[model samples]
Target: MSDIGLFEAIYSTRSMRRLKPDPIPREVLDQIITAGVHAPSGSNFQNWGFVIVEAADDKRFIRDQYLKYYREMERLGSIPRMADIPPDRRRLFEAAIHLAEHMDEVPVIMLACTGTDFPTYADANNPRSITATLHASIYPAVQNILLAARALGVGATLTTLHYFFEEELKQRLHIPTDKEIAGLIPMGYPHGRFGPTTRGPASDVTHWGRWGEVGQEV
Candidate 1:
């Protein structure tokens, strides 16, 4: 394991988009993928796949599509201006813009996908919506990937903007029609430092037995 302790990793594993062009070690990549597969799944059905992309040609294709949609979103006023976000998040927004511009240069990209149609256990209006549970089978694995990457001192960030062209992405990558891409994770050495994330104190967000109870800090 890395010198970084588990709690430290959790606190310092910021979503890092400003990454160096250095390649991640093959062994390290294998470790991260192994970590992801170990994550628990509903009913022990690990219906997830991780598609790793490193070929220059593939990255170029994905990057072009990402830029096309990002630019269109920005022009349509869908992507908020950095100045409009809170001060604490301005840096993150700036980093996102930078990533969008240089995405093709990143050493590796991983696409997390589900292998089947979303499982439905209830009507759309059910208090616990089926849509919410649909991701329960895969998101734990995605979180495992992020945490594992950080443990290896690899910089990474989760993105879904590519979903704007999901069908196109599948066609370009030859991803099976039954699979749904859940997230895109770009990984490399960080050009910037890893640090604690900013957020409201735990006490402010935690509750007791009831909602809005605002109990003591966790």
Candidate 2:
């Protein structure tokens, strides 16, 4: 929207955990949410709901909830040690730790949720398996939010660590029990710079007509 082309937005959108506390303008926030709403939904059910937290008290409440488990994980040695991860990704984990510590200072916390349980084809008795419909319905919108924020020069990252306390979040936010929390996005101006993402080359991961057939000629 800010003259950031579509592919430019896509390529530059990074998971920004180290974010400044500067408040996002209301107009920019609205545009990000609008971008999310415009995403495709299965059957056009449009069952998603979003809650944006900017109030100090609400941010504290959610941040405390997140830290509860985060601290527990730390005490239990569940968090990956810096020495364990490869050097290339060690910085990301470090930034995640920083975010956990300062989550209360985030200017905005966006919670993306589904307003209704997704219809499933699996038998009710053995419905422990996840269905594609559930993800297919909500994840596109989450991606749109990240891209839109990037285009607006806002930093955004999708996280589900808060999902561990989803029910508590619903009660605190007054979201009904029927709704499902898809993602929790932290938004603000980035303390770090945006850059192209690092990843395995597409050729290494792509398959042609068959599985386990990487780099097949077109």
Candidate 3:
């Protein structure tokens, strides 16, 4: 709503793992939460909830949960299932293992959740209209937090692997089984310099109208 230099913010955000370990102040955490809750929701259902954790023990617990899942994936031979995946793809996932091992080193973690049950996904009266608006709503808030962090010299990345083992995560976090954990954002000051990123031009995916109904617009 502020139209506060969004292009720069969007272009600057990237997944940053290394952090400076300086704690995020409570006031800024409040602002990030406020920004996320302000995200558009379907019919004002306002189902988004964010849990912010900075305590050392809690952070370690979450990181261990990640390792539990990662080990399970490795045991199940999920890595080889990516036989079709290029080496670059494999490296990224392997990096996830490294991040999990180091997750506790970050200064803060924000968990974005929706107050909806898994069964609701199959419910005929499911608030598809409501939930659909949620990601769009919360993500901008996430972006706002990330950009604000960058501008403040903090580093962060929003990731979602925890949701893959939602049951274990719920048991560990004591969150009810109903809520949908959308993502986990880890934040802190950068331990190293932020690097330049590469991306394709917008024209590759942008369409003037009637998506993919190409060759008809200027």
Candidate 4:
């Protein structure tokens, strides 16, 4: 129940990876999920599932798995080295590493999952057949959760690193076989401050009537 305006929340809500270990109140967590559930879904299916993880043992297991897979990916050259990252984006890279190193310290980890029954027209031969529409159904709710966390002064970031070890995670958490995890968000009080985020102007990427056209027509 923050008095902050919606646009203000939207503009200032950066992905906060450096979070404190201090526990968030249950009511605040409830509000965040409530906001998530209020988001729209395709065909009004609203077939989303959220798993809020707070147990220390569970967090530790997830953290270990994340680090293990992260290092493997790095070894395979899937992730760029520190020297390879652009100077302007290195901070984000560093922050992500920091989170991976200390993910267990984060207070709450929310798993955003989607039921598999949503209809799709993707070709069966395509590897990414279900990905596009499946994400379309769940990511809005994830965005809502992030915005709600920001308004409530909780730090959070959407991550999909868990996807690497998703099957094990589902087994450990007892998630249904028919659902797929879309995003994993770690939430807590921030170790840093929330501020305005930098981004290119919409007009820079916006096109009207056709591609490569900038600016709007009156």
Candidate 5:
């Protein structure tokens, strides 16, 4: 297969909420997991772990794990704060619930874990910059996985609601408690096709130096 550029990858990927019931091959899934390890890590610590769940029993458990949050939210009634968001975002959250409600049907689930928490080295409190940087490292890996899967005709959706019950998840999956669960991405073959996507122009958000300052040409 030909090499895929970053732009092509970005354009090719969508949330892919809907997926085929067919199973993903182990070898092909391995390639995606390996791709995640290539991502940059904070201070070159390289402490990330990618967990892929494909077994029906395991996927069902993971799906149940995802439902915990929505159930948690439902018990509390309405969203926790953030009412200021437009209707679209509220709907997006609901859509995520819809997806999670049926997550057992998705063929694969990937959990990105940090393996261990960052060590503190200062007074009462220093910036948790290292942890945030570690998070930044994982997203690129997730991006590559999504892109690679798209190129192979597999659909993927990166999710995070399960993070709400990280400890419970760790216990169920036997993941280390020290590890920070970054995100959960569910992937499988698409029942639909992918093509071009519409988005805001680069000029809309590109800033030269300052937040409000735009480049002369843009």
Candidate 6:
């Protein structure tokens, strides 16, 4: 395990999309998944399922699907125009595009999934039937995986573009029908450096005892 402090890990973890093609060691991958499973889940059900993809064909398929959907979104005007994106964030946006184009070359792809007995909100007319809280069970584990990867010097980014063609992905990957993939994280050694993320002050968003009750900065 890394000797880095907890807060240090939390603060410096960024969505690293540009990664080297070098394969990560199996032991390191095992430790990263172990960190994910250590995270708490609703009712302690611990129902998350992870799939680590290393096959060249599988990565190529995923990359093709990602580009297909990305192009469709662009055609539909769902994605913001280049000029609309803020100057500081344009680099990140370009990095994401780079990832999409070269996703097949990434060394590892991890799918963080959850089991579902009930129909998802997308499939059902009544959103309440499948409580939004269902996601609460899986995202913490995803965050843990990201933090662990950062601490171990692996670059990873959580992406959901696959959801656009999720059924095809499930069939291609042989994921169970009962499982829903929440996040697809491509992982490997970084082509760049890990550094602190840029964000607005937490005090600007934090409310005290009640809504509109702003508190002083910590």
In the range 121-210, model 5's lDDT, one tens digit per residue, is 234264576556667757777877888887777888887777677787788788976787888888888766765656778787888888
lDDT per residue for candidate 1 within 80-178, as digits (tens), equals 776677897787778888888888899999999975544545345564544455477888988889988998889999899988888988897889998
Model 3: weakest 10-residue lDDT segment is 115-124
Model 4 regions lying over 4 Å from their true place? 120-130, 215-218
Model 1 is weakest, by summed lDDT over 10 consecutive residues, at 115-124
Candidates ranked by lDDT: 4, 6, 1, 2, 5, 3
Residue-by-residue lDDT tens digits, candidate 6, 1-218: 54678898899899888899998999999999999999987677787899999999999999999988887886777876567788977998788888989999999999999876443445667665555545777899999999999999999999999889889889988999988999999999999888798988888888898888776785
Worst 10 residues of 6 by lDDT: 115-124
**Residue-wise lDDT of candidate 4 within 1-218, one digit each (tens)?**
54689999999999899999999999999999999999988777888999999999999999999989888887888887788889988998899888998999999999999976556543465545466767888999999999999999998989898989999999999999989989989999998988688988888888887898887642
Show where candidate 6 strays beyond 4 Å. 118-129
Q: What are the per-model C-alpha RMSD values against the true structure?
A: 2.4, 2.3, 4.4, 2.3, 3.7, 2.9
Clashes of each: 0, 0, 1, 0, 0, 0
Tens-place lDDT per residue, model 2, 107-140, is: 9999999745555543565443334566677899
Error of 1 at 120 (Å): 7.4
Write out the backbone clash pairs for model 6: none
Report the alpha-carbon TM-score of model 1 versus the true structure: 0.90
* Top of the candidates by lDDT: 4
Q: Give the deviation of candidate 6 from the true structure as CA RMSD.
A: 2.9
Relative to the true structure, how large is the alpha-carbon lDDT of every model? Answer: 0.84, 0.83, 0.70, 0.89, 0.75, 0.87
For all predicted structures, in order, the TM-scores are 0.90, 0.90, 0.76, 0.92, 0.82, 0.92
The alpha-carbon deviation from the true structure for residue 202 of candidate 5, after best TM-score superposition, in angstroms, is 1.8
Off by over 4 Å in 2: 75-78, 120-130
Error of 4 at 103 (Å): 0.5
- lDDT against true structure, model 6: 0.87
